[model samples]
Target: MSLFNGTIQALEHSLGYSSAKNRAISSNLANLDTPNYKAKDVTFKNYLAHEFSRPIQAKTTNSRHIGFQGDTQPAGYKTIINQASSYQHNGNNVDVDKEMADLAENQIYYQALVDRISGKFGSLQTALKGGR
Candidate 1:
């Protein structure tokens, strides 16, 4: 009877990742003119893979095992440093075009995830109301 099922959890995680990516892109854009400011990025592929691969196990020694912990949601996004391809005259490494593109893409992804979560909740609501 968990309101946040696996799909919901995954979508939430993706939303978090998108949020982090958006923040990173914003930071990079903000420091585009700052001297010696290297662009940073958040890696989500590895985290998504790890989340998918990890099994949700309950702490139990007998038949009366507790599933509360196992029912908890997965971890959120993580930020990491990104190596810049080139450095500018002022020692800044942020590429404006790249950062803009990343921001746009991340925004799209975030919106899609939000839509999916909304749809899921809508369906749950419909089910609860007996399809009324």
Candidate 2:
């Protein structure tokens, strides 16, 4: 189980990040017409860097050695609720073009991550079935 712990953790992190990002984007879209609404974004890279900076414990051959415990939710993935420059007369700062582009890109990345995780599981399944 320790052998695949890193991969599993990475997949989980990716899924969580994507889900949070999607939620933030959806919220922004919903508030598009709200006065003085600013779009929020998830800081995924910062989270990854922070997580990577932490020292990881390696499993030992000793019977008493405990396995490494990864973070359930890493820090630095904070939502930035910065105010956007208002261009419209209604004081709304939502940029439809940028939002749409971001949404599409995020969706594509999420799908790719899902596919990769699925492939990993498929490989595990194949190995478990004696490589049939």
The lDDT leader among the candidates is 2
lDDT of each: 0.76, 0.81
Candidate 2: C-alpha RMSD after superposition: 3.4
Q: Could you tell me which 10 consecutive residues in candidate 1 have the lowest summed lDDT?
A: 66-75
Residue 72 lDDT, candidate 2, scale 0-100: 53
Among the numbered candidates, top TM-score falls to 2
TM-score of candidate 2 on Cα atoms, chains taken together: 0.79
Candidate 1 residue 113 Cα shift, in angstroms, is 0.3
lDDT of 1 by residue, 74-114 (tens): 55557776655556888788888888888888888888888
Candidate 2, residues 43-89, lDDT tens digits: the string is: 87787787787778676788898876654556646788767478567
Count of clashes, each model: 1, 0
Candidate 1: which stretches are off by over 4 Å? 55-76, 83-85
